[model samples]
Target: MSLDSWAVPSNTGSMELTDTTPVHLIHVDPDVNMARFYGIELQPTLFGEVSVLRTWGRIGTNGQAMMVTYDDEAQAADALHELERQKRRRGYVPAGT
Candidate 1:
């Protein structure tokens, strides 16, 4: 995706900051030597849109990222929650947990 096209406007209007904190989840089991990580974050765009950034790959690697633009923060937040739930079902848990 080209962020160059999302030029910032002079007035950003009433844009409230939502949960921009990145959520990092990991799953590891020594028996099967399975170790993986999944991260999700919500970012505000210059064009007044919200972006959901997702990254997943093996632990200790740079991994891959995919950005999905949403019309608003609420929609982006919902998408983030849904992804978290799916990951949790797959044995993924918060990094510190």
Candidate 2:
């Protein structure tokens, strides 16, 4: 099968703050009532490893966002794929209306 141009492409949004390229962001709310949110954002880095940001728990109450760095691009890609798979398994869809 072929992708429709938005299948896991680079992320483009206000969430990206630095000049590093954005990979993608996956935000899933299992409850969908601000009860909780599971989100991830892949970002590029010039020096050091790629950045993967993860956010979970209640959105405005108990949610937490953290960033972890990988040693290389391949490792980062692998992590991204693994995360996407897990999110899909949990019925998490792309964010927005």
Best by lDDT: 1
lDDT tens per residue, model 2, 22-66:
333344445755344566667766665677877776546556878
- Which residue pairs come into collision in candidate 2? 11-23
Q: For each candidate, give its TM-score against the true structure.
A: 0.82, 0.54
Model 1, 24-59: lDDT tens per residue? 999999999999999999988888889999999999
Instruction: Give candidate 1's error at residue 52 in angstroms.
Output: 0.3
Task: Please count the clashing residue pairs in each candidate, in the order shown.
Answer: 0, 1
* Residue range with the least summed lDDT across 10 consecutive positions in model 2: 16-25
Off by over 4 Å in 1: 1-16
Model 2 accuracy (lDDT, Cα): 0.62
Worst 10 residues of 1 by lDDT: 8-17
lDDT of 1 at 54: 99
